[model samples]
Target: MDTDLEILLTNDDGIDSPGFRALHDALSEVANVVAVAPADDQSAVGRTMSNEVSVEDHELGFAIGGTPVDCIVAGLEALGPAPDLVVSGCNTGANLGAYVLGRSGTVSAAVEAAFCGVPAIAVSLHIPEEEWPREPAVEEYAEACRATRHLVELAPVRGVFEHADYLNVNAPIAGEEPAPMRVTRPSTVYEMAATQDGDSITLRDLTWETLGAGEVDDPEGTDRRAIADGEVSVSPLTAPHTTEHHEALDRLADEY
Candidate 1:
């Protein structure tokens, strides 16, 4: 048995979600997985932390009344022993592109864990809005779960966590087996447009609708492009605000 392997599972889609359930069951096969996820969908909530949170016992695991980040924090500090890794997602929708990272609660949970010095992975599936069912799509999500399981099995041996704090993975819908996994960077180009209607302003994300039109100037070999080409994208990401030497700042400080 892999006694050394332990994983903390979480998601933005809530505890009752089939996506979370599928991932938890799959992860349990290889690693000791403990799920502590939101009680309700908290997608796009980002890294927001609440002062007070409520937790309830559920059939799958503990349902948390907070953002995705809270679930990871609770899992690590309150649920059980410190896990060897944190895995967030199998999210209902894809969390791709550079701009989406700051807005995706699923990916943010992994980012939060990375900040705590724990290796993490955020897995999401790309689905066209038109194809999305009225209800949650468990079967499609399960396909992504299979990929997640494979990554979990190979993560340790591949040394994926060596240089990266966390990995952001977005897999296209399964057809044959899977196209191929590509190491990529998040695309900077986005299609976030806002419309002002009276006093209320509505923000509409047009990435999906416009991406097919070749309307975006996003470079190739990016997360978006990888998924666009029906390949899995594995973007190794670092924690918030990576530090770099600033000559101008240093000079200013010296003068002061």
Candidate 2:
């Protein structure tokens, strides 16, 4: 394990969330953990940075009245020294599948950190749909936090960032014992639905319902599948939007 490593921690669920505090406590055991996070929930806002934000001192660390991306910028540029690693979340809900990468504030914070040239990890917990409308206790995040701490302790020495810019980690709710961890890829399943009523339309995502039933058709080696199998899912990913060489575009440009 790396000794005396400085870690910058932030989350989309706000600085006061139980999941956030759980992660803070877990990481503090291994490194110098500084918490600079939103003053209130900023879920699903994705990489939205503010030109200015209000900052206040808190028991854990600093709190910013802005999005998760704002917290990362504030932490890196003014609040603290450049961190050896930036960790976002232990979020309230799972950030699974390829489609969710850009829509998740937790993952977006890690994305911003990666663009700033720091390795990052975004962690979230999968809660069953039946558990909604109930507050999750701090103990409920133990497994997720433990898995995250494990990666924080080992990923640096293993050169995980050499091949990947950031990691997206999701774990099932805490069980009697710590869950096993697995390397995985984002699942490709998309489950959006819409309904029109009179002059109104409602948009819904049915994936959560599927996940609750453990009936998603996600194959092996996918984040969703791993979580369904009662294991921690870690998806190593890069930050940049990649594009392959295109002969058609090249021909169009040449003709012009």
Candidate 3:
């Protein structure tokens, strides 16, 4: 077994963001870490990959002028030696629920790594609405750094990535004792709201505001409920879109 591990760390937040830097510094304690993140914030950009990416050098590592997916692909294909693990985020905010898993550029980096058959972890901090000070702050990301460190140190075990193609971690703010770590699935509940102006449509992100109010039907073990209850939520996710047998499609194929 390779005692020394190499880790590729990236985030949707720009390379200069505190969250990304904190995570990079913390993970360096565990293994050799490489940072390949966007030059600017790419949050909620999803798995979209830019055809053209410009790379620049940073103190931490390389900052690519592209999406999270671009960073991961460039890191794997051309950045450096292939990493033993890929870690995304220490994001500014939590990445929870089914709606977010598909849309979060932070998690999308991990998903992009999983597609390359590399084990990956995506970590984020859950900043409660009440926790925000009168002034906007990004200090809560330290909690996420702590969680990422713990997971990285302990990930040398069997089956750590066996069932979960990639791990999605959402940690509550700092000063909390180890909340019960629950293995969960992404919640289906979504708070997508949109409005129309005279000529343009206006959309709003209501997920952060309505963190306390959740759906009644949300199951016992889901990323949403686990986070709402102030626990560290760990959801195991698989890469690749699922393919299922379709009788109707099969009939159409036969007609062809």
Among these predicted structures, which one has the highest TM-score?
A: 2
lDDT of residue 163 for candidate 3: 75
Best to worst by TM-score, what's the order?
2, 1, 3
Candidate 3 regions exceeding 4 Å error are 1-3, 130-139, 205-208, 214-217
Give me the runs in candidate 2 sitting further than 4 Å from their true place: 1-3
lDDT of 2 by residue, 1-256 (tens): 4557999999999999999999999999899899999999999999888899999999989999999999999999999877999999979989999999999999999999999999999999888777865667999999998989889999999989999999999998898987889999999998889999999999988887898876878999999999889999999999999999999999999999
What is the C-alpha lDDT profile of model 1 across 1-256, one tens digit per residue? 4657888899998888887887888788888887889999998999999978999988766889999999988888888768888999888778888888888999999999998889999998787667654445566665577778888888868998888889999987667665688889998876678999999999877887766554656567898888777788899989878689999999999999
TM-score of 2: 0.96
Clash counts for the predictions, in order: 0, 0, 0
What is the TM-score (0 to 1) of candidate 3?
0.89
TM-score of each: 0.91, 0.96, 0.89
* Higher-scoring candidate on TM-score, 1 or 3: 1
lDDT of 3 by residue, 118-216 (tens): 989999877666755222245555566777777777764667887778999998776546566777898877776789989999886676567744433
Error of 3 at 114 (Å): 0.6
| TM-score-superior candidate, 2 or 3 | 2
For all the candidates, what are their Cα RMSDs to the real structure? 2.2, 1.6, 2.7
Index of the highest-lDDT prediction: 2
lDDT of each: 0.84, 0.93, 0.83
Q: 231, model 2: CA deviation in Å?
A: 0.7
The residue pairs found clashing in candidate 1 are: none
Total clashes, candidate 2? 0
